[model samples]
Target: MYTDNCYSKIDNISVEYWRVGIYCRLSKEDEGTGQSESINNQREFLKKYVNDAKWTLFKIYIDDGYSGLNFERPGFQDMINDIESGLVNLIIVKDLSRLGRDYIQTGYYLEKYFPEKRVRFIAVNDCIDTFRESAANDFSPIRSVFNDMYAKDISKKVRTAFNIKRAKGQFIGSHAPFGYLKDPDNKNKIIVDEEAARIVKRIFEMYLGGMGLTTIAYTLNEEGVPNPSRYKKTVLNSSYVGRNKTMYWDATTIKWILTNPTYMGSMAQGKSEKLSYKSKKFINIPRENWQIVEGTHEPIVSKQEFETVQKMIERKNNQDFKCRKTPRLFSGFVYCGDCGSYMTYNAKRNHLYLICSTYKRFSKEFCSRHSIQEKTLISIVIEDMVQMIQKYVDVNGIKDKTVGLSFKDGKKKEIQDDIKRCRDRLEELKAMVKSLYTDKVKGIISEEDFLELNKGFTDEKNGINEKLQKLEKKLAELDRKEDEKREIEDIAKKLLEFKTLDRFILEKLIEKIEIYENAEIKIHYKFLNPDK
Candidate 1:
């Protein structure tokens, strides 16, 4: 019901001709819409009150299944707009709680918005009317506070109930997953939907039969097989379901189905958590922390088939990593000496070759090809590794066809000092940028000045950051050399090793193989001679 503008006194302005609006809201979740007089009863009572006062009935605003905790309700927003536009001079609700359960917004409307607009407010059931003086007005604010607290308490109770259901291996999500339906007898439990389960099986079968994920999705879409979203919306007719613009099988959806343990009769809960009672944001919880209950229901797929499919998926991923256009086992371990860029590994169907990345991009204009056969490079590195061990790691070892690692003219201290200075300068620049932003917000500087000065500082900081990065790379190279030397020394002392080259040995001993024009190669080992 609306307020009694006729009964309230406001600077001798009579309520006889005042325009009145009645608002009623019912959230089916929290408030049972069918219970008591409810919305219909509230509307009828409001119409009668306006008639009794002989006031003009502007309109009746009703928001069904909407939360009063927020003022974003369409009906409520329309009422507020009308009030501001002078279309309605007085507002009324069934009670203060009916208007809203948020104390801050409710109090603001009662104390500030309504008064400023010269509009009278009334809550009939609460017996507080601005038109007529009563002690209820004094308690209205306190009552609204209680309403907010009630909403929070109710929210907590509902969450507790949901958690209890979830812990019992029950499916508490708004909609059951694609291949299953909520059990009719016990809504918390799930029962497989045979029709949807068939589709799920087909998807997995196609994937395990060597079909790509995207290809399987395309085939399903071509066949007009309803995706998870479509099945929920059209077949199941779930009220909470939202249809996607294009209801077709997608790779991401297919992948989720394949990965889900639910199809194997496993129950999972606590995959996500809301920020707090008032916040609507939800963050994903790690899988390790998820509550699981095995053999919760009849599985759509066998665990054995599911595990085999997982292995197939892993093999496919590894193959992709190995044959990615020009993938190489020595990837990240080959570089162009001239341009200082890693060489690209290319498989020419018959032979493997390495080409400078810079040369490939711009031909000889940037840098020479620095190309070399994979076999030739391997032979050169093996020879160098043996020589390195005999000269440095094993000074008194038996003779080997190799050169020794030399360590002279090392500038460890100077490089370390430069790195420390760059870091300190970078920190200072970050602090200055932060202070500049604060000054701009405080209006101590104009926007134009702030933009120009901030850009200058950022550019200077970026330049210093680049120098720091180069220094770090240099330091890492030095550290890698020391580590390689120690490892090789230990190996050589054990078995006079460093003869054959395996993938593991190559990765551990060599940092990168630099190729130059005219088939020249440079072996940059973990323990590279500093003077070289």
Candidate 2:
């Protein structure tokens, strides 16, 4: 009976059919620290074992400077593809830890994936072989747990060290801010770059001279000055991409530089932190939570000048500068009918009128200047409102007007369905982009094909996002109009008692007032008009 069972087991041990794929990984922490764990050393050792066993060496895969915590490495993914294609029947690594550091995934691959795929796996240093039954194979799970613990410990220690460095007011960032550079003598300190510092000073001077942010950006771009992003790549030789196709100066970039305290000799650190050690996502830290150390670097602008500029920026943003104390009644409601630009509020010489902002700011060639007096607009709006109130009073006869203010269900449902489809497509596109990047990294797809597909995906994504924004804005406007309509209808019920108009009631009744040529006026009410 024993001889018969031995013959049956011998028939299944097919060693000659083994096609081996040797895998090796060397992270930054492991490189040059251990000679035995080096890529070349791991390759030679695994090859010797395969030769001794008389197995065919099909290919060797290496993931140099890649962490074992994630299985997204290009070389590792290539080996998995070969196994699925039936090209590789066996895989060998230096040790169990070489496969991965994450215990859950490493265990899943070794215990389930390899077995289900009918492929053999081995770790020479750990004496693990799936084809042969051994005590070492049973202990692999415990080993994986230890490896995971080691990675966590290392991550904690590195974070603690960085925190200590930041507390000392040291400049630990890879690149200095726009107007500064890392000191040659001490990398932890920063000094002003004279060439860039001159540009920084010019920006401050322009702002103080009553030049708007957009005008300053346009002047710098017209002068052929490289933006901060282009300067870093071409001049500073950093790997960070500006992500700007044209690399032109813009108001957003100017505002960032203007607001940064670094120019005033303060070193701000820990502005953002990663979600976790395993994930690459980062969340920005609030300004109050940021670690700020004053006088940690050379000053590019005086403290007094910086404080004055900050105060001016605050005052301009408050909306009080345009009207001197409070916003006008029709300040935000008027627009130009021809060019569709917001109308500027003019109160010059006791004359109140709204004119096309585009014509006032830019050349007349871009747009036409059409003006309508505020008094005339109010008169027109109040007269139309009174007519509507008379119609409602004739029909309803002073009854409650706030009971039924909701719009028809058909319109709301159509908009809601469109929003749902757009949101679903956005999620699908995000997943597709991630998969496309992985395929490109694994060499399954060519670079040219990837770029073409990526561009198409990006265009579709941008269009979907813009559509969603518009749809959401439209829905919000509809809801706000319904509520305002109810409020105005209540006031309209009392329109016969008080035949007067105020800013509050006018604003609640009208969404926009458009000024056209030949002194023509068009009013867009928040609520629907039965007369129209």
With a 3 Å backbone cut-off (N, CA, C), the pairs that clash in candidate 1 are: 2-92, 7-131, 8-131, 387-402, 387-403, 481-526
State which candidate has the highest TM-score.
2
Candidate 1: worst-modelled 10 consecutive residues by lDDT = 398-407
In model 2, the runs with Cα more than 4 Å from the true position are 1-16, 31-33, 180-195, 210-215, 221-224, 233-239, 242-251, 293-299, 302-532
Model 1, TM vs. native: 0.55
TM-score of 2: 0.59
What ranges in model 1 sit over 4 Å off? 1-8, 11-15, 32-37, 131-135, 182-189, 233-246, 307-532
Clash number for each model: 6, 0
Q: Please write out the lDDT profile of model 1 over residues 1-532, one tens digit for every residue.
A: 1244644445466556589999988875556436653788889888888888778889999998787787899999999899889999888887888898989998888888887787778888899886566789888989999999988887788789878877778888766788888888987889999999999998888987888776677677667788888788788886554334346666667778887888888888888888876677999999889877889999988898788778887897797577776535677888888779989875556678888876554335456778787877777777777666556544653232223432344576789999999999889988998999999999999999999999999899889989999999988887776565566556665424436566667666677777878667778766545345
Determine which window of 10 residues in candidate 2 has minimal summed lDDT. Answer: 1-10
What's model 2's overall lDDT? 0.80
